[model samples]
Target chain A: MNDVRSINCTQCGAPLELHGGHRTRSLNCAYCGAVMDSHEGYKVVEQFHDTLRPHCPLHIGMQGVLKDVEFTIIGLIQYQTEEGDTWIDLQLYSPTHGYHWLSDEQGHFIFSRRVRDIPKPAHISNFKLKAPVFLGKQRFYLYEQYRAKVQYVEGELTWIAKQGNWLNITEATAPPVCLSYENSVSEEDYYKGHDAHTEKEYYYGEYFFPNDIYQRFSVEKSAQDKPEGIHMAQPYQPGLTAAMGQVGGYFFWVGLLALFVILFMNADEQPRLKYHFNQTELSTPTLIPFKVEDPQKLLEFRISVDRLTNHWVAYEMVVQKEEENVLIVEKEIEFYEGRDSDGYWSEGSREARALFKLPAAGEYSLSVLFDGGSQSTPPPLFVELYEGVVVVRYFLLLMALSLLFYMWKWFHRRSHENRRWEPVTEDEDD
Target chain B: MSTSPYPAYNCAACGGPLTLKFRYTKIITCPHCGAGLFLEDKAVKMRGLESVMADYPSLFSLYENYAYKTQKLTPIGQVRFEYAHGFWDEWWTLMSSGEACWMSVDEGDIAIEQLVTLDKMPFMPDLQVDVEIELLGESLRVTERGSAQCIALKGEIPEVIMIGDNFDYVHLSGAKGRLVTLEVQNGNLFAYEGQWIDPFEVKRL
Candidate 1:
């Protein structure tokens, strides 16, 4: 056997030579008739032997970063390029799905006709000039043309390119300026809205160029350093919380309004729960008929409170006089009670139908208390001792405070959950 | 005429000054030398219709606005950029994601595909793959494995290529070892790649 010479072509899979033939700067493949020329310089590829196959072969999803004249693989490729004198075609999948013909010319691998039908992350495109491009989950066309310059920093791949820029057809065209910082009248203030170094300025909400290129393009930031986007956000829409706040606030005031209305509207016949000392228990056991002169005087005894039960009711004590000490009997009195279906107050007796009789009298204290449990929880009980400029003002202030406390707790819980969830990883299928 | 980059139009076949003609292109045909001299970029431009020439395959993409519009074509070999659209949008309409895209000769047609699924691609065999990642101006051989093989590196990947999620494909090419950078802006594959791929097949490919 004449030793078959065993050399192979890296591009078209043609046989290559081992020695003298490669020295002329241009070499001809015996089989494929391809002319390989070195612009800067060239390397002679060895034969495709079993041992070499283990060292240098192309595979799928194989990612390669640009190295000095050589591509160092970072991932993998799914398909191989049709062999050219100095190029190899491949299909890549990181930024998007597409095909590329990678060529190794002199000390550089040139990529051409690489197609992608997907969005990519924020990065500079190798085929375009320096600009921030958005890569996401959308169908877009991207073109990148770059040469290989191998330099590693802390074991990281880094290469410099002369020129490259790209275009995104479907993107919103422009991004609004984000200026979350402004107005301190110093360097500290300017740094807030401006990244200083990384900050990129744009003319419209549609395009972003380099910060220095503004002389050629239209670029402006707001007078204030408030980071602004195209969409200005509004206060949170009244949701269950907001609506509740409105209702809470409305009824809170309305409830307050209703409380004042009950106190004042019934100025003539305020539901007064007076402690009538029973004549049978007193030494002066005379049955003296009692008449109320003005109902507005009743407001001085009971307090109005709001409860979840959706109605206003009053609670007070009925007492009987015994020499010097007073007896207590707690009872609830709903303002709506004792009223006919037509909502008119019902009369008690024949002689003076609207009149109520008290057997005896003594100084008494009025206390309003809430009735705990039943089909409905009792309305908040408010006991008014003195009805005047001082008492009424103090009562209203108390009600306002209680409403604010409830709202603050609700909002705090909701905001906490929004920040807790972890964002999805990059590898998972979107 | 602009000064030619080369010294003489000599036919590789016969060592003689060949007369340039557009038999179809800027090929130096030696009426005397009888040798073929193909000056790729120059010859194609001289033909004027170089703008109309279909250098690569015309792929019909139902994904973009101009899904199947026809025009000239060029081959952008391979460069990484983010496939910045969603899977469906990028693959079908060129919407959403970013991808590391490159050109591969399929039969006679050139097609663009993302690099994420390339590892399992039926067409890509189990060849040895060596990966180098450039991060923060640093070059490092991050992964070297067989097909379907993966290697974890320590540098931050501003973005990674995924099957369903969009990503970026960095285009690496430049003088010496320094690679130039460019981006795939938007819509119509051939028009986009045309910016980078040389019109002349001889010099570019």
Candidate 2:
């Protein structure tokens, strides 16, 4: 509910216009730069002799359009930091839309409206980059934070805005839109310049592009020369960045899909034959014969050399081509395990396998020729023949390929994001 | 703060007085001659011929200023395409701040749009209209699907303007404020999102 009030400046003796919105406790004289307490019959609370007016294009009663909504400028407040950094805020009010604000700071205009639907963190300081905060269904990321001291004030305002107000302002930008939280760090946060105090908290801000602002309002510039300052939201390549995100997402899912399909296809696998042979069979370094029942597909022979730690067993294996003609193939199996400061580490493998396809599915003979072994303890050797075990090998290769593809896509996206956040966010949120 | 980067110039083709509104605009339709002029690095050339869009005149016309919210906008150029149902026009618009957007007439409705790139679409181009597809945090429906041949083009284009070119596109409708269109052009998929805007709200200047 808005309670209208009227008062005259004590110093300038000019009529001071008061605004609606039940929050005005102080009003500044636009004529003589005199601060007045509107509640106490236009009492001269504070006065400034120096003329330090911020450059503003809109004045009270001037109407402008933003986001296709028509709003009138009703008030203007100037806030300065301890380091002399200052920005001007123009209060915008519409009969149908209530109230919002257009803040011009360092040539960058921020269109802001108080948003109650924002989910704030328990501590306002918890806002930082990579930390996600949600507003409605849209999630916003904290981008920057600042602490400002409100230095001066003027015009009609909703809140009794005074000077020397210590406000902890935290901002998170989602490009085109920025989420800002103004917290009164303490009772001293609202200084009211001299003798007034106003407290407000939650705020939602959006970075209006220069083009959008130019279209929204008739901007009156002091410099009628060249257009210089770039809009805060100007450099963003929305179309390209949006496309990059989409492409990155597509590549990532494609890689994941390929990985899962490969895994599912190899989940069920069975070995054909598993056999054990003792030193008595391999003692005679001669070719010992064996026959396979079926060998249409490629069969792999895994020889497990059951030797001592750090020991190796070397043997020559031969598979007959069904005509009793032996084809010699050499193999060695060794395994070593040891402990160090970094804990136990293992090297080599105790098993070695050879895979090859036979001429046909008919009986194919195979033999093992042991080259080096001690006869004292019968050399224990086990052989396992597997059918269609190449799936696992192919899966490893595909997984690596998919991982590489995703890595490349994400790396490409990272390059774009680096540009998005490239501007050093230092003291930018005035 | 509003200044046209290119000052008032004469249309080379029609020798008519033309003024460019936006800073980044490279093409504009001559108000007097209605000829599309492509501003090049050295000279202005005649762009693709303008093809008629609708039987009745459009409520908005080329080079005319229309108020979209607090900002004043001017329609710069237009591209005409024929779909399965009929023909539609996409008007190139420049905002007061020099930002550009495109407008299309969809089923007797004005759809204000901007080019947006999306990652991918779940369904193919053959997805039926009204099939709900969740994208960009909104539930969008598959709407228009057909090949649109660029039969007529006039005005400024950010890129090269080509007439008679064709592309197959799938349009997805998201609520009243959002429309997603996925178009496949020469094997490259392009996406654009738009909102259905009320023509009554547009103040003709």
* Model 1 lDDT tens row, A300-405: 3433334323233323333333333233334444323255577746422111101122333434333223333342444433332332212355567756754674
TM accuracy, model 2: 0.37
TM-score of chain B of each: 0.17, 0.77
Model 2 regions lying over 4 Å from their true place = A1-8, A15-25, A48-51, A82-84, A185-200, A220-420, A423-430, B1-205
Lowest lDDT block of 10, candidate 1 chain A: A153-162
Using DockQ as the measure, the top candidate is 1
Q: After the best TM-score superposition of candidate 1, give how far the Cα of residue A178 lies from its true spot, in angstroms.
A: 14
Predicted candidate 2 versus true structure: per-residue lDDT over A1-430, tens digit per residue:
2223566678877875655333344567777778766556657777655656666655666667876666767688777655667777888765334467898766567888765343546245444565777666667677656667555566766555545546777666676677777764332533433212223346667776554565466655553123234333334543554555556556557756866875676577555555676777666544434545555656678888666576666777766764475466788776788999999998889788787766655455556667763333436778776665444566556556655655665565566566555553443443
Two-chain complex of model 1, DockQ on C-alpha atoms against the true structure: 0.02
Provide fnat values for all models in the order shown: 0.00, 0.00
Query: Which runs in model 1 stand beyond 4 Å of their true positions?
Result: A1-430, B1-205
